[model samples]
Target chain A: MGTFLIVDDDESLHKVLVRVLKLEGHKVVGSVYNGSEAVEFIRNSKTKPDIILMDHRMPVMDGTTATREILALDSTQRILFISADETAESEALKAGAVGFLLKPIRSADLFRAVKSCLGEK
Target chain B: MDPMQIAWHLMEGTNDIITSINKDGTFSYVNRALMEKLHYSESEIDTLSIGTIFFPGEQKKIKAIVTKDTHEIISDVQTIMVTKEGEMLHVEGAFSPFFEGGKKVSTIALFRDISKQKKMEEDLERERNQTEFLIDIMTHDLANIHQEIISMLDFLILNEDLPNETVGIIKEGISEIERATRLISSVRKISIVSKALPDLQCMDISLALLRGAIQARLAFPEKTLKLVTDVEHGEYFVVADEYLVDIFYSLLHNSLKHSKKKDVTI
Candidate 1:
């Protein structure tokens, strides 16, 4: 399992995700609230997560902007958008996202999509 | 400058074939643009009729517009014509009647080479013909690969005699894969229907949404439905076409498939 950095606005998701991800033998390196925080974290941090789950909606910055900023910092960054919004597909794809897990993503899919992005599958 | 001098300069400078033909369709005047593109010298092309460029039997269309009464400008349209090297070139432009004394004595035609657009269209048509091959890969070939993972999961769960908890998780994973495959099949059907480009019809969209929820229930037996409309339920007429139900099915399925919550409110 790969190390994941989750960027979602919903605080409730952080606990549930950690519980589900830890059970799958994956590690959650960090969790951020908005796109700006994610960008800041990625840029300033020493150890980077293997895959990032970017949320489509947020308070300060959206996932697409965060994805763009992170990629600009490091082109090899692997980021995904797990969104419930149907209209997010085109925007997510346009932002150079590697994969998208439509919400409410099951435990198995979250694992699979992460592994796929990590080049494990 | 004199009128003839200005006319000559305009004809020679533009990036189009400008030629005036006689009433009998024999070329009377040829511009530099025409000579350059058709690879014909001025004197040689003046002897050639406009009919020389027309594709075989298609010359009759030009010839039929013989009299002043029948003369009209043929506007931007695409047609095939033989170039100087006998290569078929797609030309897109117009042809207009030239009058000497308020009576049409000849015609002047302007055309630009459009072989690039024609080539692109031909390539697209070729790819479009391979739709069945694409569908085959999406459905049949892809399913084979998916089945391999499933069979491996099955072997591990059954033959190896794993712990009950581990086996249950494996089964859950397999079910997820199965769900994904079913989604792919549904996507394929919808993709094919959408590509066919059905005509749009006005219908009660609220009714369609209600019917679509019913369809989703039928399609996925395990999934429960609780469709709530933001608007009051009534005859909500909308400009939509076929597969209105499929649209709702896709939207409704996404929420159901991934939601950890028992009761969804979308």
Candidate 2:
């Protein structure tokens, strides 16, 4: 079982992702509401998660900025960008995200993304 | 040099009523124009105080100008003054300090009736305020109904698991409502924003464009689509609102739905 952090502004989408990931037997470290909180949590954590599922658009700070800051803190952080907006995929890739998942994300697609980021088949 | 000669010259030459008051407020000089306008003789004018000719509220402002130690000028002050017949007239005036050598002597005020202009300005201001109030009520209050309808449709799309036919009907209904709402909202927003437009914040434009393309793909899953992104390595920021990105997403969704080709590029 791998630990993962889910960050998104939408509460409903966050809850859905948490439920689905939990059902997949992954240990959910935490779920946060915005990119800034995700950065703060990652910076202050004693142990980093195996993977991070990040949303692109949020208030205060966005996923791209959070990704850059988090990677600055720990270069080995594995990030997967998940958003409803598809245009963020390449930018997320440039920001060092291993995978990109669009909104209304299927369970299979999400599982595959998380697995891909974890370097498992 | 003579008081009567000075008074006669003033009355014959100008329409203005020339008057002088002593330090005790008794009238010292009154022109023929003054007597004709007020129907008061020179003797009657001398017996009356300067304060007696002022309207109740005008006394305060007049007193302030009169009692100042140094030379002072009051310009275009609008206030009411009373005639000898006790009729109130709205007037605008300039009050200047009169000086003898280095000492303050008296205050001389020249005034004109401005009741017509004052009434016109008040009417114009009232109309302007009423128009603004009506517009605010329509946009802020009535526009919320459209927003609520959009929110409800979003909820339905996210939560409801209906048959394909029912989903199609609901989606069509949502599209029609959105179209009508956009038209009304745009008109209202244009009027409101024209009055006061907010500053835009810098945003990542490429990210928004990419998100718009992805949302289009999701909206039409049956269509084979290719979203070609050409975002540079460095930061690509532009000034815009995030809500506009969602509008672009909606436009792309419409394009994808209507496209006849097997492969559509965004």
Candidate 3:
């Protein structure tokens, strides 16, 4: 199990993801609405999450930009992008995301990706 | 004035560039409009050949029109012309051979400038491309919203305490969301097809039919389907894209869904 931070514009998604991640025995460190808040959380929070679930399109800022900023803040932080836009995959990966998951992702796939980030089977 | 002079006067008054090419390829006559558009005077035109008036890039096509062995009328031939200052002008025209005593003596051609229309078409194409890019962005956002709804619904369905009826309702809503996603995908495909020609290749249509039937079977597991086709005996090859399978799938799926009986034949 690993600690996680959720960054997405959708509040309902945060609720479900928090519950789901808790059910899998992972710690929900924090949740932020956009890339700017995510970067702020990473900077000010006492506990660093093992993985950050990043979303691409948001009002204040976008995931790829945040990914670069967060990695610059803490090179050890692992970011995984979940987005509906497949076109952003290359940019996200190039900006230092661990993985890119297309939206409408099944819970099974989501769990697998999180587990893989922890070097688990 | 004679009838010939009257015809000459009529040709001279028009904005269209008109010219006659002799058997030896030299210009025998050029209307006033032709001389003005080409920046050539009456005396200068006598020294010019038919080939010199056409843009260098259009020389090959012009050669075909002028060197034909038989007397034929060529209409709506769009070509580029070069003025004396070496500027290119786009024009469309018809060319007809003038036969004297059953022998082709010269060719009379008429051309009208269409550069402005071509530029407008190019601008419209650019606007269309921009619209497509915007549509793609919208589609991505819509898909994200759909994904959020689906994830929430899936979480709700996981609750063991919920009644079977409520679970069934939630499941139905999820299915509807899936249908909406498919509709978006179809619209995007249609937009793409409208913009460019589809890449076509020879494909075995029988395989596509079989795949479609398999898809339909998976889609409607409750319905018993009997697909009868003569595709097995021969190779049914056609030039088409991957959507051919979707076409067959839609037809069979619709037929199966609408049929009242449990068993369907198609």
Candidate 4:
């Protein structure tokens, strides 16, 4: 089981992703609204999550810039971008995101991506 | 008949308006069609000019075209003109520089009234914008709502230790949510067809069928479905997108809905 930090503007999604991750035997370490909070969460936390579920569109900061910032702080940080916008897939990947999942993501697909990010078979 | 006379007769007989304006925007010549459409008589022609004929809002634009320096034809210049009654008339026409003794002196303009076409085009654009706006709400906002419901259902299915029948019912509810999501996706695809092409990739047809079967079974939990196919997963591939799964799901859902037998094999 892996640990995850959920970052998304949608509160409904945060609840769902956290519950789904917990149901699948993974720990949701933290949840934040935007990318800037996510950066702050990672910077202050003593124990970082194994994977970060990043969202693209947000009010204060976007996922791409946040991904770049967090990865700059720690290159080993794993980020999996989850967004409703399909166009953000390439941008997320280019910004040091390990994976990109479009929104309305099935729990199965989300698990697969998380497992892949964790380097699990 | 002389060709010049025939040409003049043709210009006079056509429904298209023809008028020549001097450098100072004064009417040099006005065809019968122009005079009749603009409600100007030969006696009143001296009082009319480019400024008097063009719609008030369109005067500067029309004047620029009429007084342009180009000898080349300015084609399909769409603008509004005002009739004697002050009614706006949509027109699209061409302007040609009229030269005398190798010096440009006036502009000869020919116009066809397109008020009906313009109204129809504007109505269509308004309707299209409204449709796209609704589709945006459905795809983004409504889609999130659907996702929330699906997630709730999924959570119940995994966490709740309910009876087998209750779990089946919950699964059916999730399937209904998926169906609604598919409808929203279909509307999104239709709206974006003119904007961008579909993203097609090499998809495993068998996998799509399997996924469809699983989701379809969720919709009919009371029924025992046995999908018997010779095709193996990853063996058969087709150029398709995620819509392929939607198609398969729709077909299987219809088949299951119409079937009378509780236990069906396909």
Candidate 5:
């Protein structure tokens, strides 16, 4: 089991991801509306999560910035950026994100991606 | 010139039908042209009040005219009027006031039959509405079908192991779905282009192409693919919709599907 943080502006999509991940036996650490908030939550929290599912387009600060900051804080941080933005995958890669998932994401794809990020088979 | 003779000459020369009415609603005079158009006799016109000639519930309109400040009222107003043979003529008219030295004298109404024009306008409106409805259905319904086909292909790729022949058939189905989706996209593009120029944003084209290639690769793992970025760093930017990058992704997928050898370049 892995602890994951979901960062997305869409509440419906966040709920869906949480439900899917929980069903797959992953513990959801928390969820926030944007990248900046995700950064703040990670800073204050005593426990670091196994994975972060971040969205690209956010109101204040984007997934790329958050990923860069998180990795700066700890280079070994595992982060996956999820976005409807078609340009997300490479951007996430450049920012040192582990992987990228597209929006309207399938449950199976999400499972595979989360497992991949967590270094699980 | 006498008042009646002047009125007669005015009506005879103009295309419009003219009639004069007293404040009491009695017809003081109707020109010969008007009499011929209505097929009414001089004696009959003289016996009827101007209000009696109007179709039912037209007294309110006549009252409006009497109370109006303008000396001339030219309106595309619709109302029915009674002919000598008791036929109802759908008419649109201009009603004007006649005055003698600042004292109210009469009301002169000029009218034309407009039933044919009204019918044509209604038919044109209906056709316009139907065309819009059809376009809406085509955009939404076809898009849904395209999405469903893509989803089914994804499901098949993930869960099922099939023979080479079955895989070939699935690839063919994907091609068909791609064709249909392309057609819908072209229609949507035409509409957007016809309206106003789209506001383009500067984007990294090479990165977009790479992401699209990666997505295509993930979608079709069986196909061997090679992507080379010929674009220079930061120089790869172009002005276009960020979402429009999907077009390149679709094109790459199509190219990969048809490549003879295992290796394909985008």
Candidate 6:
């Protein structure tokens, strides 16, 4: 199990995802509303999350911009983008996200992605 | 004044560019409309040949029109005419051979500007293409997302130890999203049919319906749904595509899934 952070605009998504990951025995580090908030959380928080589930297309800032800023703050922080828009795939990768996953993901797949970030086989 | 002089004044008053070109392809007479359109004085036009009046690359089409021998006037021939500043002017007109004293002397042609009309047509085409593209993306991508949402909700319901009330809410959410997905797919199918009308072909629709029935039965092995059709077996031809089968399958599926009866004829 790994520590994970959730950054998405939809509060309902955050609730369901947090509950699902928690049920799988992963630590729920924090939740941020958008890219800018995620960057702020990463900067201020002393204990950084092992992985970040970043969502593309948010109000304050988007996942790509936040990922770039967060990576600058901490180069090794693992960030995986979860987006419904496939058009933003290239931008997500360019911003240094480890992977891109489309939304409505199963809990098992989400757990698997978290494990992968933790370097599990 | 002679009868021909009065006729010339009447020709000059019309909006269209009227010109009479000699058999040698030189301008015999260019009306006031023609001179105004190209910003050319009568003396300037007198010095220019018919070939010089039209830009190159239009020569072949112009030649075909000028050389054709027919008693009837040929209408709707599009040609490019050049302005004084060398700008292309789009025009459509009729070419009629003029005769003098029982001998063919020149070809009389009338040109009307169609540039604005063409531009409007092009804009409408672009708008239509854009709308189709957007509908396609919404149907394909949005439906996929909706499917994913339902899948997640189903898994959560199955695996989680949630309260009965919470599970009820989740199930309700799932049904609503499914309905939304079906509506989107229906709209997308409509757009697809409109955009792909040319792909329609004549085929035996009976075979397609039978296949749809078999697929529907396989999809719902537990449900007793009968596919009822009055189509004969010889050859029921239909100008359609694979989507026709999908339409039948969806109808059968929806009928069976919604009806309260254990055995429903669809």
| Candidate achieving the largest DockQ | 3
Residue pairs in candidate 4 whose N, alpha carbon or C atoms collide under 3 angstroms: none
Q: Is candidate 2 or candidate 6 better by TM-score?
A: 6
lDDT of 1 by residue, B1-266 (tens): 99999988999998777777677878778778767776778568755775787677656766655444545788886667776787777778777887777788887777788889889989987786687457645664444445445545655664466787898777777777766665766666565665676668887788778776765555444446777767556647878775686688777877676777666556
Residue B217 error, candidate 6, Å: 9.9
- Which lDDT values do the candidates have, in the order given? 0.73, 0.69, 0.84, 0.84, 0.72, 0.78
CA lDDT for candidate 4: 0.84
In TM-score terms, candidate 3 sits at 0.56
lDDT of 3: 0.84
Which ranges of candidate 1 are over 4 A from the true structure? Answer: A1-121, B66-68, B101-103, B136-182, B185-196, B215-224, B229-234, B263-266
- Chain B TM-score for the candidates in order: 0.72, 0.52, 0.59, 0.73, 0.54, 0.67
**Candidate 1 residue pairs in backbone clash:** A104-B258
Query: Which candidate leads the pack in TM-score?
Result: 4
Clashing pairs in 2: A85-B211, A86-B210, A86-B211, A87-B210, A87-B211
**What docking grade applies to model 3?**
acceptable
- On a 0 to 1 DockQ scale, where is model 5? 0.04
Give the Å error, residue B171, model 5. Answer: 5.8
* Better candidate by lDDT, 2 or 5: 5
Candidate 5 backbone overlaps, count: 0
TM-score of each: 0.53, 0.41, 0.56, 0.66, 0.44, 0.52
lDDT of 4 by residue, A9-99 (tens): 7888778777788878999999999999999999999989999999887779999999999999988999998776665789999998988
DockQ category of candidate 4: acceptable
For candidate 2, write residues A2-98 as lDDT tens digits: 8988887666655566666776799778888889999999989886789988888777998988998999888889988876444467888898877
Alpha-carbon shift of residue B233 in model 5 (angstroms):
16
Residue B191 of model 1 has an lDDT of: 55
